[model samples]
Target chain A: MAGLLDGFLELLDVLLRNRVRTVMTALSVAWGIFVLVVLLGLGRGLENNVRWMYRDDAVNSIWVYRGRRTIPYQGHPVGERLRYTNRDHELVEARVDGLEKISSRFYPPIPDSVRWQGKIVAADFRAVHPDHRYLENTLVETGRFLDEADLLEKRKVAVIGVQIVGTLFGDHPPIGEWIDIGGAMFKVVGTFRDVGGVNEESQIYLPITTAQASFAGADRVDQVMFTIDDAHMADAVAIEDEVREMLSRAHGVSPADRRAVRIRNNVEEFVRVQSIFDMLAAFVWLVGAGTVAAGIVGVSNILLVSVKERTQEIGLRKALGATPGSIVRMILAEALLLTGTAGYAGLIAGLLVVEGLRRWVPENDYIRDPDIELSTAVGALVLLVVAGCLGGLVPAWRAATLDPIVALREE
Target chain B: MIRLVGIDKTYRVGAHPLHVLKGLHLTVPPGELLAIMGSSGSGKSTLLNILGILDGYDGGEYWLGDALVKDLSERKAADYRNRFLGFVFQSFHLLPFKTALENVALPLYYQGVSRKERLRRAAEHLDQVGLSDWSGHLPGELSGGQKQRVAIARALVTRPRVMLADEPTGALDSVTTQEIMDLLKRVNAEGMTIVVVTHESDIAEQCARTVFLKDGRFEGER
Candidate 1:
C-alpha cells in the first residue's frame, strides 16, 4: 500500500530489526564474493609473473648457437664440431625472409678478464654486433649502443652494464673512459640495464668484428640471434626450417641432423607459455563465478526463510488490501537492496586487498603486483547482484501466491 | 450498500469436499450496523471472508454498491477490498513491526494516498479512537484494549464503505470487550455501515439489527 520509498522504508524496518539474521545472511554473501575477488587477483599476479619471465629476451626472436656434432654427410666426417662464422651470419642476412634485426654474440675466448684502475670489476664480457642491443633486450641508460660504424671500423668501444659502471668507474665519469679487458683497452661508450636481471646488467658488450679480428684471428662467432617481424612471427617454424637447410648446405653438414644446427625457436616456447596462462585465466573465472553462484544461492535460501516466517504477515497485508503484485514488488525490492549493498562491500574489500598486496608484496620472481582492473571488479559486482535477484525470485512468488484466509488461520 | 445472491462455498480437506455454505441470500442497506451470529462450524467466518473479498465463492453474485463481485482475480479482489471493505480480526492483526501510526496509515497507503495525507488522516482516526497519544507505540507495547483501538483506527483510516469485524472482542476480557463494543456503537452512530460476526447474544443485541446463521443459511432475523 505504501509508495515505493515508503515500501522500501518498511522493508528496512523489517530487515534492520532482525539484526542478527540479516547480517548472517549478508555475511555469507560477502564471503562468497570475497573469495572470488582474491582468487582472481592472485591469478592475475601469477600471469604477471609468467609475462615477466619473458622480459629476458624479445619474445619473437630465434637463436642458432654453435652445434655440438653433425652426422657424416656428403663425404664430411661424422664427429666434426659445427662451427658458425661471419659467412654464416652474412648468408642468413641475405637469404632469410622477414628477419627484423640480426646479430651475433662473438665470444673473445677470455674469461674473468675485465678490470679497470686495477679493480676487478667481476663482469662477463660479450663481443657482439650492433643490433645485439635489440637481440639481447638491452636498455641503454647513458650514451648509446654499438652502431654499424662501430662494427665496420672495428672500434674498441664497449657498452658496460649499469652494475659494471658502479664496480669499474667508482663514481668517476664512465663515458669515453678506458677499461681493461684481458690486457686490451676498450673505451666505455654507454652504460645499460637489462630486463634479463642483475646478472645481465653486470655483464659488458663490445664490437664483434673487433673481437674476431683481435682475439680469435678468424671469422668465428658463437651464436647468431635475430627477431622476426610481427607479420612473420606466426610462421616462425617455417623460417627456422629454411635457415637450418641453408646453413647445413652452406656448412657441408646433414640437414636432418638436429644437433649439428642448434636452433632455439623462442616463439614456440613463448606461445606455449602464453597458452598455459590463457587456460589459467579461464579457470580463475570459472572458480570465481562458481563461488559467486554459491553466494547467490545462499541469498535465495535466506530470503525464502524470511518469506516463510512472514507468511501470516503477508496474509494480513493481503486482507488489508495490498495487491499480490505489490507484495511481490516489496520482497523483490528487499532482495535487490540486500544484494546490492553486500556485493558492493565485498568489491571494495577485494580492491583494498589487491591494492595492499601491490604495495606490500611489490615484485617477486612469481606473483608480482596482485591486482585486478576496476572495470572487471565492477563487472563482477553487477553480475552477482543480478544472480542474487534470481535467487530471491522463488520466495517472492511464494509470498504473493499464498491464500490469505489460510495464511491468517489461527492455531 | 451490500447484497449477496445464492452464495455457495466449499472446502476440500484431503480428498473430502466439505460443503461449508449452501445457497444463501442477504442484503445490507446503506449505513446499517448489523451482526451475524453463529456457533463454530456454522460458516460465519467463510461468509465474512466472501464478503471481505479475502476468499472467492464457488457460486454467487456479490454486489458491493453497484459492482457485482464474483469470480474476481486476487488483484481485482484486493482492489475492491482496499476501496470498499475494512477488516478487524479478533486477534487485532496490527503488523507487529510497525508503529501504531504506521499500522493506522496502511489502509490509506492501499488507496495510493500521499504519505503526508495518509499520516494526517491516520492521526485523525487515532484521535477518534481516543488513542492519538499512543500512535507512535508499536503493537507489542500496547494493552489488549489499546491494540483493538489501533486496529479500529487502521480499519477506519480509508473511510471504507463497510467495516467488517470478525469476533472483534473474542480475544479480550469482558471489560475490554464492552469497551470495544462501545467504540463500535459510537462508530455506528456516526452513520458508517458496519458488519460484525459473533456468537455472543449481548454483542448482537447491541447492534441495530441481527441475523442468525445455522449451518450456512440464515435461520431468522432479530
Candidate 2:
C-alpha cells in the first residue's frame, strides 16, 4: 500500500513537471471520445427518425393487393386479372387466426374534385370500411369519423382531410356542411389529420358501401389491410401466407400463383428496418473505436518519448532500489490518470451536447432527440481505461528493461 | 562487509569490445573507509558500479554479507541494493521535482516505509547532514555543496550496510569538497562502511585506505 502511494506520488510529480505535454496528450484522447460519442448519437437520431415514420400506422399491419393470376387453376387461364369482393374479406376474417382489425378500401379510377359553394379543389377520394380509420392512423381533428350507422345505413357522410378542408372551406367550418362529389351532395362529418404530412392529409374518406353502391357499380375492393395481434407479429410471414391462401381460394385463384396476390407485411418490414439500424449502429461503433485506437496509439507514442527523456531519472530510481514492477506501475498509473481524466471530460461534454440538442433543437423529419445509450457510455469509459493500459504497456516495458548502468551514463 | 573475486566487465563500442574491468578483486571490511582513484578510462566508475550492484559483472563472484550476488534477477538485485547498499553520484542525482526531504525519503519508499515514518527518518538524516532547514527546498534551490549534502543524506537514510560515493564532491569547490569529505569521515566514524571513487589524490588521501586503478586492473593499495 505504501509502495502504491509512492508510485502515485511519483506519477503526479512527473506529470506536473510536464504539464503542457500531458494536457496535449490528454486532449487528443478527449477529442477522440468526443467524436465517437457524437457520431453514435447522430446515428441513433437517424434511427429514431425512421421509427417515427412508422408511427402513423400500425407496424404490425399488412396490406394485401389483387394482381393478375400467374398460374392457371380449374379452367381459369394464366394471366387472368384477379379481383377481390366482400366475400374474400369475410372468408379471410373467418379463417385467418391472430387477425386483429381488417378493412377493405376502394378508390376512384380518376382524381375527384370536391366542390363547396363556388370553390373546387382536386383531391384523392378513398372509400373504406369504418375500421380503415384505425388501421390508417387517421387522427380526427374535428367532429367524429364514420360510424357503423354510416357504413350500415349507406349514409352520404364524408370525412375530409385537414388539407382538403383548408383548400375548400377557407375560414368557414367544414363539419355539417355539404360537399359535392360527382354531382352527389354529401355531408362533411369530420376533419382528420394524418401523421404522414400534407400528402396524406389532402384526401377524402367515404364509406365503402356508399362508394360501391353509388359509383364503383359492384362489390369491388382495390386492397385489403389488416393488423395482427401483438403476440403473433413475430410470425407475420406465416400469417401472410395463410391470408394469401384463404384469399386465393375465395377468389378462385391458384395459391401457387405469385402475382395473383401481393402481401406487404409492415411487421416484417419493421423488423428488417430494425436490423438495418442495428448494422448501422455497429458500423458507427467501429468507426468510433478506430478513432479511440488512434488516440491510444498517440498516447503510447508520447509515453515512449517520455520514457526516453527520463532515462536518467529511471536509472536513479532503479539504483535506489525500485524494482522493475514498481517502475512499470508508475508509468501505467500516469497513463491511466491521463486517459481516464480526459476521457471522462469528453464523455460529460458529449452528453451535455446531446442533452442540449435534445432540449433545444427544433423537431425535423430526419432527426429527433439525439442521445447515446447508457451502456455505450459505460463501454466508452471502459475502453478509455483499457486503452490507457495498452498505451502504457510498451513504454513501461521499455523503462523496466532499461539497464541502470547504461541509463545512468546517458547524458 | 563486501567481497569480489575476479570481477570482469566489458563494453561493446560499435563492433569492438572495450574491456572496462579485467579480473579485478577487492574487499572492504566493516567500518572501513576506502577510496578508489584512477584517471579517465581506468575503469574506476565501472568498478564502483559493480560494488554498488548497479551493473552486472561479466564474470565474478560477489558476496554481500554471505549472500552470493551472481546472476540475480532484477527484482532480487533491487531488493539487495535497497537492503544493503546506498549510492551517491557526482551530479547529486536528486530528482529535481522533489523537495530535499522527499528526495531523501525515496529509498525508504522503495523499502515500503510509511510516508510519515519515512519523512520523520528523512528529517533526522537531513539534520545529521546539517540541511534540516533546507528539507523543503527543491534541488534547484540548493547550492552545489548543499545538493551534495542532501544526496549524502538520501544515501544514509535507508541505513544500508555499505555507502558508495562516486566522485561525491567532484562538482564542488575545494572547501566544499573538504566539508563533504569531513562529513564522510564523521559517517565512517559511526561504523558505516564507505567507498569513495574519485580521480583526486587529495580525496583519496582522506580515506583510511586507497586503491589505484590502471587499464581496468588495480595497481596498488595504500
Candidate 3:
C-alpha cells in the first residue's frame, strides 16, 4: 500500500549505484534459469526417443512370445520347452473380456526366393491374421487389407509391401501379377505403400494356411498379439491373468513354467516406463533447484556487502528522519532489482543458447535443444523473486534495526 | 524552547564505560543563538548527538517545546527529530547524488508535505541562503561555501524549532566561514533557535552565548 513509484525509483537508484554488482547478480540468476530449462528439455527429448522406438506398434497391445522354461523334472532339467498351439490362442480369445483386436503370427524359418516377371528378390515371409491391420496400425495406401475370406478360402494370394514391389517388379503395377515363392506361384492380391518401415509394410504376408503348408512346414505358430481397449487396461490385466490360467489348464502345462506360454501386458510396460521417466524428471529438478539455490546465495552475498558499504548513507537518512520501514523497503528494493534483472538476463541467454544448439545440432545427438516453454519462464521468475526477497531480508533487517548514532559513527 | 536537566550519556568500549555527558544542565529560549566550544574528546559532538535525539542517554530530563525528548521510543524519537530538529554537518551531508533543491526538500518529504509544497518551500529556503541560482547543482559541483549554504538551506526548510550545526563551517575557508556565520545570524534573528558546536573562539563569538566543555562536564558559561 506504500508509494510504488517511490519504491521503484529507489530500487533503480541502488542498482545504478552499483552497476557491476547488479550485473553479476543478474547473470547468475539468468544462468540458473537457463540450466533448469535445458534439463527439462533433455528429459522431454529422452521421453520422445523412447516413444520413437515404440512407434508403428500399439502402445495398448500385448504380445505373447514363444519362450523356453528351465525347470527340473525327475532330477534333470526339462529340455526343448513346451510349445503353444492354436487352441491356446482360441481359448484366450473366447475368455478375455478386454480383447479389442487380436492377431497371430507365423514366420517361415527359411528365406524365400521370389520371382516376378524376370526379377528375383529375397523375402522373409510371414502369415499374419487380418486383425494385424489394427494391431500394427497400418494404412493400405494402394490396395486393401486381406479379408477373413482370404484366410478361410486358403487362397494362394499375397499381400506385398511397397519395398518388395520395388525389389521384384521395379516401377510396375504389381497387383494381379503372379509371384513365384519357392517354386509355388501366388497372385499378388494387394500392394502396400510405405508406412514408416516398422509395420506390415516391411515384408510380405501370406495366408496362415499357405505359410503353414509351405516354407515353415511346421503346423505350430510363432507368436500371438492382442490389442486391448484403452479404457479396459486395469480390469483387462486381471482378466488376462484369468485367461492365462484357463489356457494353462487347457494345455495341461504347469503355471510356473513360463516357457510353456508367455504373456505380456502393455499396461504393465507403460507403467514401468512411466515411473522411470518420472524418476528422471525428479533428478533433473533436483539438479535445477540446486543450481537456482546457488544463484540465490550469490545474490544474497552481494546484497549483504552492498548493505554494509551503504551504512553511512543509511545513517544520514535516519538522521534526516527516514522511518525504519523506508530503510527496510530501500534495501529490499535493491535486492529485488539485482535478482530480477539477473533472472531475466539468464532467461534470455538460456533461450539463445537453446536456439543456437537446436539450429546447429543434429538429430539423435547429445544435448537436446532446450524448450523455453511459457510455464518454465514463469516458474523461473517466481523462483527468482522469492530468492531475492529471502536474500534481502537479513540485510534489510539490519538496516532497519540500525541505531542512527551508531550508524553515523560508522566511518 | 529547549531545556536539559541532569542529562547523562555513557559509551561502553570493551569492558569499561566512558561517560560522555555527566549530569549536564542547560536551557535556551526561542530565537537564541548558542554555541558549545570544546576540543577533541571534550564531549561537544556527544552533546550534539544527544540533543538531536540521534543517540540514547543513560539518564536525563530533556524537553523541547511541550514534549519530553528523553525516554522516547525510537519511532517517537524520530518523530521528534522530524517535527522540531534539523541538522547541518561540517562535511555538508547533502546526499551527493541529489541536486541542492532535492537535498533541501528531503526533510519536508519526511514531514509528509506535498511534493509541490516541499519544492516551493525548498526553493524559498535556497533563495534565503543566497543559492537560488545553484538549485540544480549537485553537492560535488558546488564550492565549499556553496555546499554549506545548501546544507543550511536543507536544515531550515522544515522550519524546525531548533537548528543544530556541528562545526558547520569546519570545512570552509575563513571568508566562507564568515559568510556562513552571517547567514546563521540572519536566520536566528528571524526567530529560529540555533546551537552550533565549534572549537574556534571566533566562530563562538558570532553567537550570543557560548558554553565550554571539559572532561564530560561544562567548564563555565561565557
Candidate 4:
C-alpha cells in the first residue's frame, strides 16, 4: 500500500511536470465523452417527444373510419359510400372478444358556436358516449361526465372543455349553466381538460343519442373507437383483422378490400414507434461508443509517445531495481488517471447541460424534459474505464519489454 | 563475489551478426576496487553490460556469490540485479523529474521499502556523499559533479553487494573527476566492492587493479 502511494505520488509529479501535454491529451478524451453524452441525451429527448404524442390517447385503442366501398357485395355497387351506425357499434361490442371500452363519435356537419350568459365562442363540437372520456384520456375537472342514463334518456346535456369554458364563461362557474350549441340549449354537465393540447381543449362533447336526435346525424356516427385488454395489445394486428372481417360482413363489403374499411390501431402504431425508438437508442450508443473509442485511441497514441520519450528514465529505473511489472503498473496508472478524470468531467458537464435545457426549454406537444437514464450514464463511465485500460495495454507492454541496455543507450 | 568464464556475446546488425565478447574470463573478489579499460569498439561496455545483468550472453557461466546467473528469467534477473547490483552511468542518469533525494530513494522504492525508511536511508547516503544540502535540488539544477554524487548516493541507498560504474567520470572535468575518484576510494575504503569501467588510464590507475580489453578479451592486468 505504501509503495502504491509512493508510485502514485511519483506519477502525479510526472504528470504535473508535463502539464500542457497531459491537459491536451485529457481534453481530447473529454471532448469525445462530451460528444457521446450529449448525443445520447438528444436521442433520449427525441424518444420522449414521440412518446408524448400518445400520452393523451389510449395506446390500446383502435379507430374505425367510414370509407367508400372498394369491393362490391350483395349486389351493392363498388363505389358506394359506407357509414357506421348505432347497430354497427352494437355489433362490434357484441362480436369482438377482449373488448375493454367502446364508443362511437359523431361530429356536427357545420362549425358550431357556444354561448353562455351572452358570451360566445366558436368551438368544434362532437357527440360521444360516456366511455369517450376514458378512451381519450379526458380528465373531468368539474362535475361528472355524461352517464349511460343521459344517453338512454336522450338528455340535452353537454361536457365543455377548459378552453371553451375560458372563452365563453370566463371566470364564471359553468356547471349547471345552460349553453346554446347550434340552436339547441343544453345544460353544462362537466368541464374537461384534454391531454392532447389546446386544439383539443376548445371542443365540447354531448351524449351521442341526444346529438343524433337533435342534430341531422340521426343513428349515424362518423367514427367508432374501442380499447382492448392490454394483454391482447401484442396481437393487435390479428384482432384488427377480426374487427375488419366483422365490419365487412355486417356492412355488406368484401372482406378482402382493405381500403373499403379504414381502421387505425393505436396499439400497432405504439409498437412501431417503440421499436423505432429502440433502434434509435441503439444507434446513439453505437455512435457514442465509436467517439469514445476514438478518444481512447488518442490516449493510446499519447502514452506511446510518452513511453518513447521516457525510455532512458525507464532504463534508469530498471537499473535502480524497478521490475518490469512495476513499469507496466506505472504506465497503466497514468493512463487511468488521465482517462478517468477527463471522462468524469465530460459526464458532469453533459448532465449539467441536459439539466439546463430541461429547465429552460418550453413544454410542447412532442418534447418534455430531456434526460438520459442513470444506467446509461453509469454504462458510459464503465466503458470509459475499460477504454482507459485498453488504451494503456500496448504502451505498457512496450515499456515493460524494453531492454534496459538499449534504452540507456538511447540517450 | 563475481565470476565469469568463457563468456560469448553476439550482436545482430541487419542480417550479419557481429561477435562482441568471445570466451572472456574474469573474476572479482569481495571488496575489490577494479577497473576495466578499453578504447571504442573494444567490447569493454559489452562486458560491463553482461556483468550488470542488463544483457544476456550467448554462452557463459556467471556466478554472483552462490547463484548461477545464466539464462535466468527476466523477473529473476531483475530480482538478482536489485538485490546484488547498483549502477552509475556515464551521464549520471538521475531522473530529471525527481528531486535529488527522491532519485536516491528510488531503488529502495522498488524494494517496497516504506517512504519514511527509504527517505531516511537516502538522506544518510546523500550526507555520506557530501550532498546532503543539495538533496532537494533536481538534477537539472545541480552541477555535473553534484549530479554524479546524487547518482552515487542512489546506487548506495539500496546497499547492494556490487557497485558498477560505467564511464562514471567520462563527462566530468579533471577536478571533478579527481573528486569523484576520491569519493569512490572512500567508498572502497568502507569495504564496498566497486568496479569502474573506463578508457582513461588515469581513472584506471585510481583503482587497486586495472584490466585492459582489446578485442572482447582481456589483454593484460596492471
Candidate 5:
C-alpha cells in the first residue's frame, strides 16, 4: 500500500509538471464521453415517444376499414363501393391461424345520444364482440363487458365508458341501471376506462346482435380488427393478404386494386419504425466510440512525447536500479489518471444536461424523457478507461525497452 | 574488485560493423582508484559501459568480485546494477525536477528502502558530500559543481562495491573539477573502489593508477 501511494504521488508530480498538456488531453477525452451520453439519451427518447404513440392500441392489431373500388373488376364498375358483412368476420376468424383475438365493429349512421334521469350527453356508440376489450386497450373499471351470452340472447345490455358515467351518473355507480338510447332502454353492464383519453372514454359499447336488431345495420359489420400474437411484419402481411384475397374474390374486386380492401397492419408499421430506431441507436454508438478513439490518439501522443523528453532521466533511473517493469507501470498509471478524472467529469456533465432537458423542455410526439440507464453509464465509463489503458500501452513499452546506454547518450 | 578478459564489442553503423573494443584485457583489485585515458573513438566509453553492465559484449569474460557478469537477463542485470554498482555521468544526470535529497534517495528507492530511511540516509550522504544545506534544492537551482556533488552523493548513497565515473568532470570548470576530484579522492581513501574515464591527462594524474588506450588495446599503465 505504501509503495502504491508513493508511485501515485510520483505520477501526480509528473502530470502537474505538464499541466497544459494534461488538460488538453483531458478535454478531448471529456468531449468524447459527453457526446456519447447525449446521443444515447436522444435515441432512447425517440424510442420512448414512439412507444407512447401506440400506447392506447394493441401494437399487433390490423384494422380493416371500408374502401371503394378504384379499379374495375370482373363485371363490376370502378366506382362501386365495398361493405363488410357479418359473414366476413366468421370467415376471417376461422381462416386466420395466428390471430389472438378478432372483433367486428358497427356504429349508428348518425351521432347518438344517451339520456339518464334527464341528463343528456351526445357521445359515440360502438357495437362490438367481447374481444374488442383487448383491441381497444380498455380497462373495465367495474362490472363486466359484453359476453357470449349477451350476444347470443341479444340482450339489451350496455358497457358504458367512464366519461359517460361522469356526465350522466356523476358520483353514482351506473351498474345494473337503465339508460335511454334512441328511445330504447338498455341496462348498464359496466363502466370502463381507456388510455386513449376522453374521446375513447366517452364512447359506449353494445353487443353486435343487440345493436344490429335495434339500429338496422342489415347484418353488416362497418369495420373489422384483429390482434396477432408474437408475429413479426412478415406474418402480419401474410394474414392481411389472405383476408384481402377472400374479400376481393367474394366482392368481384380486381386483384391489383388495393384501395377496395384497405388494411392497416400495425404489426408491420410498428416493427418498421422500431427497426429505424435501432439503426439510429447503432449510429449514435458508432459516432460516440469514434470520438473517444480520437481522444485516445491524443493520449498516446502525449505519453510518447513525455517518454521522449525524459529519455536522459530514464537512463539515469535505470542506472540507479529502476527496473523496466517499474518504468512501464509509472507511465500507465499516469495515463489512467488523466482519463479517469476527465471522463468522470464529462459523464456527470452529460447526465446533468440530459436532466435539464427532461425538466425544462416540453415533450412532443418525436421525443420524451431523454436519459440513460445506470448500467449504460457505468459501462461507458469502463470502456473509456480501457481505451485509456490501450492509449498508454505503446509509450510504456517504448519507455521500458529503451537502452540505458543509448538513452544516456541521447543528450 | 573487477576483472575483464578479452572483451570484444562491435557496433553496427548502417551496413558496416565498427569494432569498438577488440580483445581487451584489464583487472583492478579491491579499493583501487583507476583511470582510463583515451581520445574519442578509442573505446573508453564502451569500456565504461561494459564495466557498468549497461551493454553486452560480443565476446568477453567479465567478473565483478566472484560473480560472472555476462548474458544476464535484463531483470537480473538491473538487480546487479542496483546491488553492486553506482554510476556518475559527465552531465551529472540528476533528475531536474527532483530536489538534491530526492535525487540522492532514488537508488535506495529502487533498492526497496522505505521513505523515512531513504530520506535519512540521503541526508547523511548529502552531508558527506558537503552539500547538506543544498539538499532541498533542485538541480536547476544548483551550480554545475553543486549539481555534480548531488550526483556524486546519489551514487555513493547505495554504497556499492564499485563506482564508475564516465567523464564526471567534463562539464565542470577547472576549480570545480579540482573540488570534484578531491571529493572522489576522499571517497577512495575510505576504501571504495573507483574507476574514472577521461581524456584529460590532468584528471588521469589524480588517480592512483592511469592506463592509456591506443585503438582498442591498453598501451601501458603508470
Candidate 6:
C-alpha cells in the first residue's frame, strides 16, 4: 500500500506537469459518468412510478364489462344493442369455483345528481356486494361497511368517500347523515378514506339489490368484478372460460361472439404495463452505457498520445533505476485519478441537475420526477474507475517495456 | 575491480548483422582513470554500454565484483546499474522538467534513500562539481557547461563503483569541454574508477591509460 501510494504521488506530479492534457482527459470521463447517471435515474423513476400506480388494486382481480352486438333483427340492422342481466351475475357468483370474492355493479341513471350538504359534487353510484371491501382494498374511516344482510333487506344505507365529508360537512363526520341521490334520501352508513386515487374518492357505494331495482328498472347488471385466490389457479382461467360459456348459452349469443363481453385481469395488465417500463429502463441503460464507452475511448486515445510524447523520459527513468513495475503503476495511477475526479464531477453535477428538475416538475402518475439513488451512483463510479484503468493499460505497458539504452539515445 | 574477457557485440540492421566489438579483453583496478578512443562505428559506445550493464553483449564475460554482467537477470542487471554503475551522456540528459538537484537525486530515489538525505547528498555532489548555486535551476535554464556539471553531479551522487561517460564533452564548446574534463579528473581522483569514451587524443591524454580501437578490435593499449 505504501508503494502504491508513493507511485500515486509520483503520478500526480507527472500529470500535474501537463495540466491541459490531464484536464481534457478528466472532462471526457466526467461526461461519461454524467450521462450514465441521468439516464439510469430517469429509468428508475419510470419503474417506481408505474409500481406506485398498481399497488392499491388486487393482483388477481378481473373485471367483465357488458358490450353491444350489431346483429340484424327481422329486416333492418339494429343500430345499438345491449346484452346482460342480473341473473347472469348471480349465477356466476354462485357457480364459479376458486372465486375468492365476486361483486356486481349497476350504473345509477342519475349519476350527476348526487349531493352532499347543499353542494352538487360529481359522483358515481356503484351497486356492490359486501365482499368488495376485501377485494378492492377499500378502508372504512367512520361507521360500519355494508354486509350481506343489508343487500338482502334492500336497505337505503350508503357508503361514501372521504371527499363527500370535506365537500358537504366541512370536516365533520358524514356517517349517519342523510344524503340525497336523485331526490331520494339515503343514510350514510360509512365514509371510506381515499384508497387509490381520484376515481376511488369520487364514488358512492350502494347495495346491489336496491341499485338494480331503483336505477335500471330491470334485474340487470352492467359489470361484474371477480377476485380469485391465486392468479395462476387453473380454476381462475376456467372460471373466466366457463362463465363466458354459461353467459353466452343463457343470453343466446354465440360463444364465438364473445367480444360482446370483455374480461380483463388487473394483475396481468399491471405486469404487462410494468414490463413496458422495464423495457424503457433497459433502453436507458443501453444509451447511458454507450455514452460512457465513448468517453472511455476518448481517454484511451489521449493516454496513447501521452505515452508517445513521454517515451524519452520513460527510457531515462528506466536507465536511472526506476523499475518497470514502478513505471507501470505511475501511468495507471494517473489514468485512474483523471477518470475518478472527472467522473465524480459529472456525478455531482448530474445530481444537482436532477434535483433542480425535480423541484420544477409536478408529480405525474405515469412519468416520475427525476432523482438519484445511492446504488446507481456507486455503480457509475465503479464503471468510471474500470474505464480509467483500461484506458491506461496499453500506455503503461509501453512505458514499462521501454529499453533505457535506446530511450536515452532518442532525440 | 572489473574485467571484460572475450567480449563481442553485434547489431541487426535490415537482414544483415553488424559486429561492433570482437574478442575485446580489458581489466581495470579500482580508482583507475582509463580512456578509450576510436573512430565513428569503432564500437566505443558499445563497449561502454556493456561495461555499464545497460546493454548485453552477444558473446562476453564481464565480472563486476562477484556478479557476471552477461549472465545477470533483468532485475539483477537493474540493481547493478543502480548500485554499481552510473552513466554520463553527451547530451547531458537531465530530465527536462526536473531541477538540477532533482535530476541528481534520481539514482538515490531508486536506491530507496530518504528524500532529505537524497537532496542533501545531491546538493553536496553538485557543490563538488562547482554548481552549488544552480541546484534549483532546471536543465533548460543552465548553460552547456553547467548542464554537464549537473550530469556529473548526478553520476557521482550514487557513489557507484564505476562511472562510464560516452562522449561527455561532445556537444560543448572547447572551454566548457575543458571544464567538464577537469571535473571528471577531479571525480576520478576521489577513488572512483572512470572510463571516458572519446575520439579526441587530447581527451585521452588526460587519463593514466588509453586504448585505441580500429574496426571491431583494439589496436593497442598504452
- RMSD for each of the candidates: 4.1, 6.9, 6.3, 4.8, 3.5, 5.1
The two-chain DockQ for each candidate, comma-separated, is: 0.62, 0.48, 0.34, 0.53, 0.51, 0.44
True contacts kept of 3: 0.38
lDDT (10s digit) by residue, model 6, range B5-117: 99988899889999888999988888999999999888887887788777788886998867787766767777788888888989988888788998998888788777678
- Candidates in order, TM-scores: namely 0.85, 0.75, 0.76, 0.82, 0.88, 0.81
What are the lDDT scores of the predictions, listed in order?
0.86, 0.86, 0.78, 0.87, 0.87, 0.79
Off by over 4 Å in 5: A52-59, A69-86, A97-101, A108-111, A129-134, A137-162, A171-195, A206-219, A228-231, A234-239, A252-257, A267-279, A364-366, A374-377, B14-16
- Please say which candidate is ahead in TM-score: 3 or 4: 4
User: Which candidate would rank higher by DockQ, 1 or 5?
Assistant: 1
Candidate 5 chain A vs. true chain A: TM-score? 0.83
Chain B TM-scores per candidate, in order, are: 0.96, 0.96, 0.97, 0.97, 0.98, 0.95
Candidate 3: stretches off by over 4 Å: A58-62, A67-87, A90-199, A202-222, A226-283, A367-369, B11-17, B114-117
Give the alpha carbon lDDT tens digit for every residue of A20-79 in model 3. 777776776777777876666676666766666566767778777765555543343455
Task: Provide interface RMSD per model, one decimal.
Answer: 1.7, 1.8, 2.7, 1.9, 2.2, 2.5
Looking at model 3, give its docking quality level. acceptable
Model 3 chain B TM at: 0.97
Any runs in candidate 6 off by more than 4 Å, and if so which? A1-4, A42-62, A72-104, A107-123, A129-159, A173-200, A206-220, A225-247, A256-259, A262-283, A361-368, A372-374, B12-15
lDDT per residue as tens, model 6, A228-287: 776455345566777777776676555576665567767467656766877897899789
Candidate 6 interface CA RMSD, Å: 2.5
Q: What local lDDT does model 3 show for residue B209?
A: 99
Better of 1 and 3 by lDDT: 1
Error of 4 at A282 (Å): 6.4
lDDT of 2 by residue, B30-127 (tens): 99999999999999877887788877889888888788888889999999898889899998889888899999999998888888899999999999
